[model samples]
Target chain A: MENKYHFACQLIREAGQFIKGRMTSDLDIEEKSGFGDLVTNMDRETQDFLIAGIKARYPDDAILAEENGVTHDIKDGRVWVLDPIDGTVNFIVLQDDFCIMMAYLEDGVGQFGLIYQVMADKLYSGGGQFAVVCNKEPLPVYQERQLAQSLFACNSRMYAQNTGGVRQLLDQCLGIRMYGGAGISMSKVLSGQLLGYFSRIQVWDYMAAKIMGEGLGYCLLTLDGQEPDFKTRQQVMFIPKAKLTEVLSYLKGVTI
Target chain B: MENKYHFACQLIREAGQFIKGRMTSDLDIEEKSGFGDLVTNMDRETQDFLIAGIKARYPDDAILAEENGVTHDIKDGRVWVLDPIDGTVNFIVLQDDFCIMMAYLEDGVGQFGLIYQVMADKLYSGGGQFAVVCNKEPLPVYQERQLAQSLFACNSRMYAQNTGGVRQLLDQCLGIRMYGGAGISMSKVLSGQLLGYFSRIQVWDYMAAKIMGEGLGYCLLTLDGQEPDFKTRQQVMFIPKAKLTEVLSYLKGVTI
Candidate 1:
């Protein structure tokens, strides 16, 4: 647990550079279960690189990653969650929504979070007393703005399922955005490009992002008004405090 | 009709730069008709800039733009259809997907197409024997690719209304992408990132994109298999030849 925050930051930067180096070259993308799910060769390579780095430095720590799944149990006291590349579709298409993500947890409690914009070389990292930093400059968690004034990042699949939620959210927000990557979408919220983001995403997708968001005083929670379990996937919404109150009240009236 | 292609390209670039310069500052965005429709101050400014530039160069030509509507007759031998900022939502939020689009119609037949990605400084322009060019480099029109190997772009709104069409299309394609902007989505087809893009978009949103897409050998038509009319908005779909054949056949079987 010692220096976990610093360790996460270093690991994220290294992983990001690994991804950046492989961007322009050909990628071997394969279908995972369905067409919507994809895994690239770079995903495997970066996961291996990140896991190896973490295991070598913290031999007793647990690890979780998109490719290989969880390697150990949380009882080990320290655990790392990783999404080597969040937007494989964007990467395959050579678009800009892709990102690298990492998070560290101590006894099941998130201790640090990091999400890096590989192309932009911008890293968002924070936990506890440390403020969220984008490329080393601290960024304040955006204060809750009016929904009509806030930009939102969402996934189409999730938005489709939560039509009522989506409509309600959009009715209040300035606009809706679909970038196709949860990590990148969450980073927008952290960086003020979006006031909030809601998606039906896995733990690995939101682990690192939630850590950074919480550190910046943003709210990341299940839409059902419960704490997100790190072991399972859920429909979650992350919003600034001002929107949180309004959104929560609105969601309460509508039974999902 | 004199130098119409060259004039369209020049006007698009100039309008693109004007929009790019305005992107640095905050935009004044307002709802147009519904929650999904949007407009901005830059949209108006870019339109004004385009109209002025076109009028100075070709006073007798007709003009059609998003904000100003039809400024002259369509029978003026040559007509210019302009979308000052094609992805105004993207422009207002991400400041990226927006583009300056212009298409020239000579006697109601598409003669030239130009779509400038302002932020990326990339332009797709072509007419007649001139090959599609991206930043002056000739871009290969989409190769004859099968649906199983090609990526497709369609918005959630369109997907909802045309579920059968979308499901059939998705069943045949490698994947579906929701980029949230018709112009930006269509650019992918011209650039080879997407094999095609199908969506219910306005004439202003697709006119210039459709012209550029045609130059790239991508077929732009209504979803029910008809030619798109310049006078009205339509549910359009642009597809590479092989996939277009496959999808059109599939659409024929599905009851819309």
Candidate 2:
């Protein structure tokens, strides 16, 4: 397990360096679903590199990568969920604010997670066996803040749709931030910079950060305050346990 | 004029260093208007330091600082506008994503502008007499991008309110970013990373970036597609000239 974790970290670091180097070159960009849903040549390249590294080390691991869909049932064996470039738009436009994220799960239960902010070069990693860490430093203890005292993040889709009382939640929090990358935004919540993050995201988007955050005494739940189903794309509120009730009260009559 | 611009730059750098040094210590935070609107002791201290330096060097110039507000009207002889600490919420919570901004004007005409991103140590400065620069390097030329290819920013208030067809504008753009600091967000636009930024902000908030951006061939206008009044807090769009018509078309039937 330790070897797998270290290998994942090293692979992510190399991928980060690769992305940084390619930023100066023209990115071959394509719209995956529609406008704003972007995929770059680098995303595919990075995913392949990471998957190949994992295959070389742990040949039996089931992989669920962003660029490529799942090959095996995630609940049956060791699975690695990967988002090669979490903020593809940001990566294309600003050449920063993106991250490489991966999570290791055994029998569908999360065991380890890693989120590497590419430009900042900060790697946040942790699991049930060990405490969360950012680079060489252990992350600070999780300090739960009231909704009004906390800065929060939500996806623009949610904010635009006013989904699940997101606007009310915005008014309740200290302020709002939208970084366009789940890894970057969720990492901020994991590091205690943001009180909570609410977004309807995919398995690869939230899996690593969810594990890393839960290790820090945080909880990720649906807008209805239930455990989020890991198998489907869904809305999840990643927040401290103490603030759940208050946050849910505002999210009671969700618009979407 | 050159001496005054250099002096402002020097003073802002000192303030940045001071703020960075004091970040690890207690901030002595106070909410000025309500929950999200914050003002720290450092804001007052930084403002005083900047105002004092301006008075010592250019005593006859009228000064308008965020904390102290306006004393003499800004339309008079050479006026200095200062937001000692922009993005106070970010400064308090994240210890980053904030800047020190100032603009020099003569009889209501912008002369020079400076925005110092404290933590990043990035000082963006320029105006009519010079090209925009970040530290030692001149900024890249601004390119005209279609609304579909551009990332845009708007204040959370406008977003939540869906003001000026804000929600429609969100759908048309590539993505949305809310950094909670006009200086930080606008600087991104000034550097051509973002297509434009929309906000209902005050003079100190947009004045410096407006000058710096205009120097780069960008224009700042009201949501109704007119020049923003310098005397009042209002909805303003800071974007390039080629994008003006298309952006205003989406914002035609603004809710607010």
lDDT of 1 by residue, A37-151 (tens): 7888999999999889888888877887788555555435777888888988777764566888888887777777888888767888887556778878888756645666567
For candidate 1, list the clashing residue pairs, or say none: A147-A172, A147-A173, A148-A172
For candidate 1, the per-residue lDDT at A89 reads 77
DockQ of each: 0.32, 0.79
Candidate 2 per-residue lDDT, tens place, B5-89, comes to: 7888898899898787788888888878776678999999889888888889888888887895555577788889999999999
Per-residue lDDT of model 2, residues A1-256, tens digit only: 7877888889999999888888788889998877777999999999998888899988977898888564556677899999999989999887779999999999988888999999989999987686899995888768756667778888988887888887787787788999998899988988888998888888889889878877787888888888776778798888887777887888787556
lDDT of 1 by residue, B23-122 (tens): 6788777888877578888889988898898889889878877885555444456788888888776676666667888877777777777788887788
Query: Once model 2 is optimally superposed onto the true structure by TM-score, how far is the C-alpha of residue B233 displaced, in angstroms?
Result: 1.4
Report how far residue B144 has shifted in candidate 1, in Å. 4.1
DockQ of 2: 0.79
Candidate 1's C-alpha runs over 4 A off are A1-13, A23-31, A55-61, A74-76, A93-96, A137-140, A149-151, A163-175, A250-256, B1-11, B24-30, B72-76, B144-150, B171-175, B253-256
- Per-candidate TM-score, chain A: 0.91, 0.96
